[model samples]
Target: MDPDLPSSSLAVVLVRARNPLNVGAAARAMSNFGVKDLRVVGDYLQPLEAARSAIDAAPVLASAQAFSSVAEAIADCTLVYGTTALGDRDLHHPVDVLRDAPSHVRQNPGRTAILFGSEKTGLSNDELSHCHRLLTIPMARGGVSMNLGQAVAVCLYELHRDAPAQRNLPEPAAAATADDLDRFESLLRETLTAAEYDRRFPGNMGANETRELVRRLGLTSADTTVWMGMLRQVLWKLRQAGR
Candidate 1:
C-alpha cells in the first residue's frame, strides 16, 4: 500500500453478501487494518445486525453505504478492483496477484474500491465488467474458496502489513472519479449514436466498448472534465445539424 495514502481512502465493497455475521466480520477486519469505507451492493439478509459482529468496528458497520448497483457504489472511486477465486470463467480484465495488488493500488491516485462478491455466487460477469482489474488470492491447489469475511480480512491484512514508515510523501494526483467516467462515457455514447457509429456495429457493441474504453483510459479529474465538455459540444452540434 502507498505509505502516503491513508487507509481511509480505500474501501471494501461487499456485493450481495448473504450473512450479517460476514458483513460484521469484514467490518472488524477493516477496522483492524484502518480502512473505514464499506459499501454494500444489492440485497442481503439481516443487514442491520451486521454491527454485532463488527466488535470494535461498530462505527464502520454503522456508516457502511448501500447501493443498488456496483457502478453506483464505486461512483466516486478512481481505481476499482474485483476479487475472484480464479474460477473457470472467462475474464476480460487483467489479473493481479494478491501480493502485487498493493503496489499497483498504491501507484494509483484518488479513492480505490476493492470488491468482494456474494457468499454463494461470486461477482457476476456484469459486475466484473466494471472493475479495472481482477485480483485473486493464491491458495493451495484444489483449496476451497475462503469464507467471505476471512477473505476480506486476509486481503486487508496484506495491504496493511509491512506498511512503509511514515515520511513526507507526495500527495496523490487528482484522478477522475467513477461518476466522472460514467458521464464521459454517456456523452461519448450519445455522440457516437448521433453519428451512426453504433450502426456500424451490432446491438450495443459500440456502447459497451465505449464504456470499457473510458475506464481503461484512467483519466485524471481535469482530463475527464475537458473531454466531457468537448463531447457535449459535439453532441449539441450533431443535434442541431439533425434538426
Candidate 2:
C-alpha cells in the first residue's frame, strides 16, 4: 500500500511514550511511509517539542495532537488496533500478526487508529480494552521486544508495501465512526434491557464484550443508521407492551 492509499484513513497513536528520541524516530517513520496523523496519549509536550528536531520529521511532529486518553485520541476512528507482544498476559481481543493486519485495515475503508505503547510497558489491559483487536510483530525469539521506533517503522513499511500503482474505481462507503458505534451500543443496550434480555443473559452483558460484538459487525455508515433505527423501534414496542 502506498502511503497515499491509506494515509488519509490511517492514524498512528503513541500511548504513554516517555522518550523524545524514540518519539522522533516514530515521527520520521510516519513521514517515510506517508501517514501524517500522529496522536500521543498522556503527557507528551516535552517529548513532542524535542521530537520536532528529528530529521525530516518536523512536519509530522508539528501537526501531532496530544490527547489525555486513548479513547479520546481514537474517538473519530472507526477501527482501533493495539500493538502487542504476546506475553503471559491473558488477552480478550483477537490477535493478528503484522503481516496480516494491513489487509484487514484496508477492508474497513474508515478512519483507523493503530496504537503503540510506552517503552517500559506495553499497553495496559485497560488501554487494550478499547482496541477492537491486537496486532503483533512476529519474532524469532520469545520475550524479545523491538525498539519503539523500529516497531513503528516495520509496521509502516508493511502497511505501505502493497499498494496498487493506481486507483481506478469509486471508493466504498466508509465504516461507522467509533463515536457513532458508541451511540449504537448505547441504543442496543437500551433495547436489550427493554426486552429483559440482560436479565436472562447476564453473562453476555459485559461492557467490553458488548463493545467487541458491535465492532465485529463491521457496520458501514448506512448499516449503523439502519441498525439504530431498528433498535429504537424494538425498544418502543417493548415499552408499549409493558404499558
Model 2 C-alpha lDDT per residue in residues 73-183, reported as the tens digit of each score? 999998899998887778799999989888888887788899999999989899999999999999986556789999999998888877664557877889999999999
Candidate 2, poorest ten consecutive residues by summed lDDT? 1-10
Position 53, candidate 1: lDDT: 47
lDDT of 1: 0.83
The C-alpha stretches of model 1 lying farther than 4 A from their native spots are 1-6, 48-57, 164-243
Per-residue lDDT over 71-181 for candidate 1, one digit per residue giving the tens place of the 0 to 100 score: 999999899999998878787999998988888778777888999998888899999989999999999862257899999999988887767655768777699998989
TM-score of each: 0.62, 0.64
- Structure candidate 1, residue pairs in collision: none
Leading candidate by TM-score: 2
Angstrom error of the Cα, residue 124, model 1: value is: 0.5
Candidate 2 has what TM-score?
0.64
